[model samples]
Target: MLKFPNNFLWGAAASAPQTEGHSLLNGKSATIWDKWFEMNPEKFNNNQGPSDTSNTYEMYHEDVLDMKKIGMNSYRTSISWARLLPDGKTLNSEAIKFYRSYFQDMLDNDIKPIINLFHFDMPWWLMEKGGWENRESVDDFAFYAKTAFEQFGDLVHDWTTFNEPMVHVECGYLYGFHYPAIVDMKKAVQVGYHTLMAHVMATKAFRDSKVKGKIGIILNVLPAYSRSESSEDLKAKAASDLLNTRSFLDPAVLGKIPEELVDLLSENELLPEVEPSDQQNIKENTVDFIGINYYQPRRVQAPTNPKVPAKMPEDLYEPYDWPDKKINPYRGWEIYPKALYDISIMMRDDYKNIPWYVSENGMGVADEERFMNDDGMINDQYRIDFIKEHLEQLHKGIEAGSNCFGYHMWTFNDCWSWLNGYRNRYGFYRVDLNNHFKRTVKKSGLWFRELVENNGF
Candidate 1:
């Protein structure tokens, strides 16, 4: 049996780009995803792009009601920067009207709306101006943040500056999985550095503007593990953690970058240019809390042959494939519940016990329709089991005194994913693509209701 503390926030998460469709309609400018899908439909699976994801823009009243019916007290979602401001300078009135009604629906349903500012959907106008790589984009994001705070800060009290900024750095720049795919380590470094700078700048604006909510960043923290206890392997782990986890974690939480990481980048001559006041600003303004989105762990060993340039991740470490690892068969992700406990323990011990929550955690299954019951509900027992196992670990972490306040699944509706499109479903309610995008709650959703009502199971 497992149980959570009193007043736990039990809910789910979805992003605007992944949920709100009508890409070019209603004065919404194209995002990187919209443009990239337009240019390279072949890149997406089955040519299914995010033309009309869950139709939340039109269906949000019904969707938020569904959330309340499922017993959710909180729902985390992002505001589309491009949708809110077509040019990133002037605000869109229709967009503001839509968001006010949408957020008011959440409040009317007695649900706390946890709003996230960015979720990798960069505006095309901003991208053309060098996106996060250019220093000017930092101020642009801050302005967006200030505007968001001014408008919706009264209605929403929980705000995150960015969700998974590292994904933007690595996917868009290093791995080229995203739009404007540039595969340069120097560009990657610059983008990553500027992203944190933007985060800090936005955080400063939030405090200075006297927003209603406690502002924070949502990081997909990958707790790194060494392949072996060898010195080289541990060194590789340090490097990997420094690059991904600590880069944002330390700055957002501790108000500083890891000195070791700075030294490494400096020695490699890959350090991004910084202003004299950046460090002091970071030092003064740290997050009130953070959202941790943990899906997997990073296992690494020293690269067999480090590149002479040694700029990319592979140049420093080799990602290790654990032999005895359990994996999710549907999505091929490693299933490691213990890592949840490990992360919480590390947060308790290493990070001064900062307040945090499990921001995004769920299982993605392909061909979920096969599990549909005759009653039209998805028989997603596998998803239930997945969430239960993770919650068990979370319970242990909380019992051990980690200041985790909530548990939010990856999504509520089967929304559109960027790279894979909707190939795999990770939602409590199945959104039918063939049936006018009908929304139906799954078996896991019922379980979620009971779990939340009971404070656990």
Candidate 2:
């Protein structure tokens, strides 16, 4: 058994867009997600949209009881900007009251509340205005962040300015994974820069506020692996690292952009429109901590076409091939536990001594309820072992002097995933979405209860 510090946080994580289902609240304007689902329902897996989610907006008190039952000492959730400010200008009173009461419930229940201002749910009005690509949307994000800090800062102690900014840039702009999907790399660069600026602004705002808490950003980081010792493969792996992780990480924690990225962007004429003041803000307003979400390791080989493209530097990495690999028996994600340790070591040594938490990590299994036995319980021993194996690597990272603060799984209860919808379950408690979404504790939930109480497996 590995020992953690006494004050270590043990909980689960969920995003507003994924968990909270009150999309059409009082005077609440639609987010990009709402608009996207409304426009194209076929984009998501199984054509399941984001209209009626887990309904956490209404059942949060019940959910908190579920958290308490599972022995969670901390809870991580995000605030939907559109929920608070429908028009991007006028604040919604009912929305504010709901979240205020939500935070107060967690604090009153002895659960430390971790709040994220933005979690990929960009307001539709802002998206129509070019989202993060336009400089004005940057100002709108700052307004949302400031508003959240001022209103919820009283009860929410830990603040995450943005959730996975790199993902937002890559998915929303570059790779077109999320709403208003665009493939232009220039827009991607601009959006990335604006997201960082928003984080910097939000961090400063939170610090200056009356709320007493820590401000950080959550990044989904995958350890990069080279296929071989060839210089091309190694360089390709480095390129993948620069684009995927270091782009936002360099500026947020180290307070500067990576030279490799800068050179690439400059050559392509896709450099972000950054003001001199933005640089100063990033340098001056570094985060107190960072939240890392790891699912798998990235394996890369040399690009077949070594020549750089006319516009964008061919970040050509040999494509990933996951054939006959070690698989998590009960889930869809490939098992690569070493990536967790490698990522933590990289953060502890390469970057500044920034404390980190496992903001989100869990295997998503199909038919979670099928594992439930006749004893009126779920016997998910595989899921239990999955969590234990990851925690072992996390424990090794901590023992090696990594400044890791906590570990939170992907979620407390089965909730809606973005593209995967409700097909996959990544929770200790399974929610029967078809039958009024009744929450049921799995064997993993009971195991996690003891794990939290013992602070180790």
**Top-scoring candidate (lDDT):** 1
lDDT of 1 by residue, 1-457 (tens): 5889888999999899999998899999999988998999999888888778889888899999999988999999999999888999899999999999999999999999999999999999999988988899999999999999988888989999999999988998888888888898988999999999999999999999976679889999968989999999998899899998999999999999999999878777788989999999999989999899988778899899897667788888899999999898867889998889988888888888999999999889899989988998999999899898899898899899899999999889998998788888999899998898899999999999999889989
Writing each residue's lDDT as its tens digit, candidate 2 over 217-236 gives 99988778887888988888
Candidate 1 regions exceeding 4 Å error are: none
Score each candidate by Cα lDDT. 0.91, 0.82
Global CA lDDT of candidate 2, please?
0.82
Candidate number achieving the greatest TM-score relative to the actual structure = 1
Model 2 CA lDDT for position 223: 72
| TM-score of each candidate structure, all chains considered together | 0.99, 0.95
Predicted structure 1: lDDT: 0.91
